[model samples]
Target chain A: MDYAARNFAAEGYHTTSVTSIVNGLGVGKGVFYWYFASKDELLGEILGDALRSMREAQRDAIAGEPDPARRIDQGIRASLHWLSENRHLFVLMEFARTEERFAPIIRRGDDQMVADALPHVSAGITAGLLRGEDPVFLTMAILGVSGHLARTLVLEQGNDADRVAESVIAFCRQGYLATGTPALARRSA
Target chain B: MDYAARNFAAEGYHTTSVTSIVNGLGVGKGVFYWYFASKDELLGEILGDALRSMREAQRDAIAGEPDPARRIDQGIRASLHWLSENRHLFVLMEFARTEERFAPIIRRGDDQMVADALPHVSAGITAGLLRGEDPVFLTMAILGVSGHLARTLVLEQGNDADRVAESVIAFCRQGYLATGTPALARRSA
Candidate 1:
């Protein structure tokens, strides 16, 4: 899966062939099919595994947090950290989004993210810790920021993930939380 | 170049072939060779054209606007409009980003966006129209929101482009402005 993700991230899915996968693995074509039914199926698994791992990480990060705000923070950090580590996968998904074929697969991952995040965000709203907003739309906005910032900061600038994680958490919380006095955290360079 | 962009956007860059372009045009390989050397060369032209078109839109939107906030608003609308019309191109670039081999090509377009916008953002800062911030970082954040929001509104949810564009402009401007003010614009629905 890593091999496929890496290749797909690098050469693009349509450009990468099963032959190349086998050649890179120093294995026969039969060995490839023995594990997976088809190249498309294999990629589906890869994309699945990549996103699942990310979702799992976020869930694990927030498993012990008592504070809703802090839990949101941990979730953002966990997501950004995972993306930084699996940048090749990030690149793969980015490429996949541009075509008719791979877009549906990518959307599945997106829908999964909204489904997974709704409970936490809704909880925040119920707790009176967050603003009354559509949990799904808020989730989408946060996801948008997290993914884009992940690419811009970690992938593009090669910056420290921990610090950028702080910013992500801050912006996300601010974006979703209800304004008591509603103050934007001033960013320091 | 339009043929290549449309093909790359629709079928994906790697899946698109010289034969397909020629066949669609009812021309022979010799006719194709008469214009471009290879698929890669053709993509280079397409990406360049895409960037140029977008840059022009941004430039035109901001030309007569005096307020930087309003200018960004217009710029966001321009971006959304372009993406809506050229959804295929966005998809193509998204696919390209996933592949390492194709990413360099896409990155060029990404970089062009930041480079082009930096001056305007810097000007905003100097004019005290925008929050005092690092132009590059601010540029990325602006881009991060714009690109993701565009994908959601124009590509994914199929929302009205004008409405989404306004939301994008508001979200980004509020995020970037020197405001400790609450985000009055949080989505309720």
Candidate 2:
């Protein structure tokens, strides 16, 4: 899977051949087919595995934490740590997002991410520790902050996970703590 | 440019031929080559034009705003409005980000976006109205928040600009107002 991921990340997924993946690993074609049905299937598995690993890391980090807000902090840090450690997966996911064939798979992963974070956000809102904004909006905003920071600080600039995670946690926590109406002030409505 | 933009947005850039671009508009191939030397050059122009338009909108909205925080608020709304009106361009830009050939083009636009928002953030920091976080970090966070909301509310969910902007502005303002040290509390650092 790592070999396939490396190839897909380095070479465009559409351009990378199944033969290249097997050849790169010095493995027989039969061996490759024995595990995966096709190149597309392999890509799907890679996406699934990456999402599972990420979720596991996030869940493990937040386990036994009773405070919803603090769990959010842990979740952000865990995500950044995972992104930092699996930089290649980030690149692979980026490639996957552009293609129509993989967008649904990517979208599912994204939705699952939001779902995983939803409970904590809901808890915060219920406890009145965070703003009473639409939970989905808050969740996506938190994710956007973390994902972009991970890409900019950890992935591109080679910064450590702790540093990137700190910035993400601080910014997100502040956003959550603010009091505001989620509805827009539309004129001529 | 709109013709080419629409075609590229609808059909993936890598799959869309220059011939198709010209033929779709019922123009001679020379007319296409007259203004641009290659399809890649045309893609760069499309990106630059979009960025210029977005910056103009942001700048115009923030003009004459005395308060740094208000300027930031105006900036976010302006960005959301521009993005709401330019959804197709987002898809094109997403495609551009994945390809190595277009990463530089996208990176330049991203860096320029950060530079444009930096002064307001720096001013807020100096005035002690906002957290004294790294200016780049703050700017990117602000952009990330706006961009994500724009995508989620405006693009995917088909929500109005005013509605999405309200949530983004509220969240960003709170983050900016929070007092926290930007540095991570690294153990054994």
Candidate 3:
């Protein structure tokens, strides 16, 4: 699965044939068919595994964290770490999103992410730790920032994951305003 | 070009052949070859046009804006509006990024975005209107938030573009912290 995923990420998923995967693995056609029905199924399984593992990482990172805000912080850090470590899978997921056949799977994972993060976001808002915006919107913004930064800064630019995570967490917690400056009342108005 | 872009965005890029594009448009293969040398060339032209138009929108929206912070806000609004308007091209861009052959074109456009936004971000920091973090990183975070939110909220959820843009700008400007809360000093520590 790892080898196939790397190949799919490196080569276009459509371009990477079952023949190539089996050839690269030094396995017969029978061996390939015995494990997976088709290349599409294989890619689906890879994406599923990647998403599951990522959710697990986020869950483990925030486990037992008492503060809602800190739980979100830890979740962002853990997500970045997972994305950096599984850069190939990250690429694959992006590619999968572009295809109609695989987009539903990606959306399911996105829904799951929102479901997982909603409670903490809601808790933070209730505790006055987060902005008084829709919790769902806030959760999406957090995911967007962390995911985008991970792709651009960490994966593409080779930045340190921990440093990027710190920046992301700080941005999520306080935004772009300089310290001591009055928080812009644009929204309140 | 519009027809081809829509087809490519609707069907997978790899699956959408030049013949199909021409047939869908009721044009002969000769017409397609005369205009675009290949399917790859056609997709490249579509992406280039989309990026150029998006940049132009941002430039026009920020025109005559004196405050760097307001310019950033205007830029985000313009970008979200453009993305919502041209969602098919946006999906095509995402798809193009996954392919090795087309990824460089996307990267060049991304580099141009950074160049365009860097001055505004730097000026904001210098004026003490933005955070003291790396200007480039801040810019990327802004882009990430806006792009991701547009995809999730406006495009997928069918939210109003203006409202989504307002939320994104607010998040980028002040973050998730509620008004009057001391901006967390986690970074300082």
Candidate 4:
């Protein structure tokens, strides 16, 4: 999957033939076909695997957090940490986003990400901790902020992933936190 | 340039051979060569034109704004409008970002974007109208947030780009507005 991801990421989807993928891995055609049904399926698997990993990390990050705000922070950090560790797949994710055939995978992952974060965000709002935010808008905002910051700080600049997470928390607090507790937003999610 | 942008944006950069571009236009290959040196250079030109258009929109949006906060709002909205109008090419931009060869153009555009927004961010801070911020970090965060939001809301969803821009502005204000805002602590950028 890594090999395929790197190839697809390096070469656009239409350009990266299954032949190239197996040949690049120095494997026979039969070996490639034995495991996967088709290039499309193979790419789908790769996408699924990436999403699973991200979800797992998000789960692990927020596992013990009692506070909604802290859960948000942990989730952002986990995502950034995952992105930092798995930089290569970001390219594949990037490629999947453009082509029509692959958009579903990207969309599914994004939707899942938002769904996972929904409880935390909603909980904050209910507790009068965050703003009266539209869940979709906040989801998109979190995704945009976390993904971009991951790209800028963790991926490109090699900044401390922990520090970047703090920034995510801070930015979210600035926009989402209700009036009070200017130091670090408290949460009940 | 528009012709090439459409082709590359839709068909993609690598799949878009010189032959396809010229043939699609019902022109001889000679006509293509007459204007551009090679396929690579043509792609570069298309990208440059896109960037130029976006920059112009941002500039025009902020043209009459003296207040740094309002200027940033205008800049974000103009950018979102450009992204919304050119959804196809915008996807192409993200697609193009995967390849190394096309990276320099993207990077140049990125640098210019942050640099363009920095002066306003700085002025706002110095005038005690905004939060204390590290200019580079703040600019980068805003770029990350706005770009990500633009990609998700304007380009992908094809919804109200202007409304999304308002969200970006509100986000920036929450993070950057120095004095007139209530306590919302812990900003990332």
The CAPRI class of candidate 2 is acceptable
TM-score of each: 0.85, 0.87, 0.97, 0.88
Docking class of 3: medium
Instruction: Give lDDT tens digits, candidate 3, residues A1-189.
Output: 999999999998988989998999998989988999888899999999999999999999999999898899999999999999999999999999888899999999999999999999999999998998889999999999999999989988899998999999988888887877765545222
* Model 1 regions more than 4 Å off: A126-134, A173-189, B126-133, B175-189
Give each candidate's interface RMSD in Å. Answer: 6.4, 5.4, 1.5, 5.6
Q: Rank the candidates by DockQ, best first.
A: 3, 4, 2, 1
lDDT of 4 by residue, B108-179 (tens): 887788888899888866766656646766777777778888877777677788788777777655642233
> Chain A TM-score for each candidate, in the given order?
0.86, 0.89, 0.95, 0.85
For A1-189, candidate 4 gives per-residue lDDT tens digits of 888887776666667888888888899999988999888889999989998998998999899878776677778888988998888787688877876777878988988898999898888667666666575677667777889878777876789877887767666657422233243321112
Candidate 2 lDDT tens digits, B23-96:
88899999988999898899989988988888899999999987677788888889999898888788777777
Candidate 4 chain B least-lDDT 10 residues:
B175-184
- What is the alpha-carbon lDDT for the whole of candidate 1? 0.72
User: How does each model score on lDDT?
Assistant: 0.72, 0.79, 0.91, 0.75
lDDT per residue, candidate 2, A1-189, as tens digits?
Answer: 998887777666766888888888888889999999988899989988998899899999999988787788888889999999987788777666666677678778888989999999989778777777788778888998888778777876788988878877777766422234232233234
Superposed by TM-score, candidate 4 places the C-alpha of residue B62 at a distance from the truth, in angstroms, of: 1.8
Error (Å) of candidate 1 at residue A28 is 2.8
